[model samples]
Target: MTTPNELRLLPWSGSGDKPCYLSTDDPDGYMSRLADSIEAIQLGTASELLEEASEALDSQGTSLDDMRCLVKELTGALRDVYRVAASRGHLLTTSDPREPTY
Candidate 1:
């Protein structure tokens, strides 16, 4: 029997880009470790992409194509990070709207 809290978190999402989780009784198994490894790689790549983007911003000679590629990579990394977080029941929270005073 597997419990929700003991389930393994997958590295990616399911249909419609929804988070997918594994209900494995063995959270310390190979697949779970693999997922963790992949997530680590994704985060690491995202960090590297951010550094490159920053460097690109400082360079006046960066080409449009190179910038576009960097944006695409960063976008993918963000999506992956989001999916992982969402899988772990983590969500983005926005502050409640405050009524404007006339």
Candidate 2:
């Protein structure tokens, strides 16, 4: 069994909007692969949304409703990206050989 520190933070949430985790020794396991694939998709969507946001901002004709919709999508993408970053950061820290000085 893996320790709490070794648990992988899943990309999606659970009931009551709680964060989900996967505890596995195999990084190439089914769940791990699924999470990796989903993360990739999430990142790609965020990248495309960023480009769209830039274009929308550049266009003077972008309406308030359009901007609102874009903002909503950006917010969800940002949340996913943040979760991915945090999970990766934790993994790196736990796998590092050097101990923190502070």
Candidate 3:
């Protein structure tokens, strides 16, 4: 787990023109970009959860020990969503101006 201080590190660390521009854009467009980034982070987080669950099942036999069928089902679904959303958001971050180029 990331400590609070570790997680407090800002995703954007520099002060510059790109940061200023992203901060000041058409309201609707800015909102859309914000939504996109939020979705991307959510998807990445869900994917990490799925990976953790799969590892637990494979290594610890939680599937048989706990009889928690929902874990298996949810892990699969989350992994699928993670795959699609992460890919789209990653490409967008790389190619779009919504994120500052560093």
Look at candidate 2 and tell me the lDDT of residue 67.
100
By TM-score, how accurate is candidate 1?
Answer: 0.72
lDDT of 1 by residue, 1-102 (tens): 455555555787689976667776565788778887888898898889989999999999999999998899999999888767765553122222364536
lDDT (10s digit) by residue, model 3, range 1-102: 323322211122246612111332343565446655655675676667667666876775565644466466666556546545444554455456766767
Which residue segments of model 1 deviate by more than 4 Å?
4-9, 13-19, 90-102
List pairs with backbone clashes in candidate 1.
Answer: none
lDDT of candidates 1 onward, in order: 0.75, 0.93, 0.50
Per-residue lDDT of model 2, residues 1-102, tens digit only: 689888989999999989999999899999999999999999999999999999999999999999999999999999999999988888887866586655
Give residue 8's lDDT in candidate 1 (0 to 100).
Answer: 51
Identify the candidate with maximal TM-score: 2
Off by over 4 Å in 2: 97-102
Q: For candidate 3, what is the lDDT? A: 0.50
Question: Cα miss at 9, model 1 (Å)?
Answer: 4.2
Q: Which residue segments of model 3 deviate by more than 4 Å?
A: 1-28, 61-102
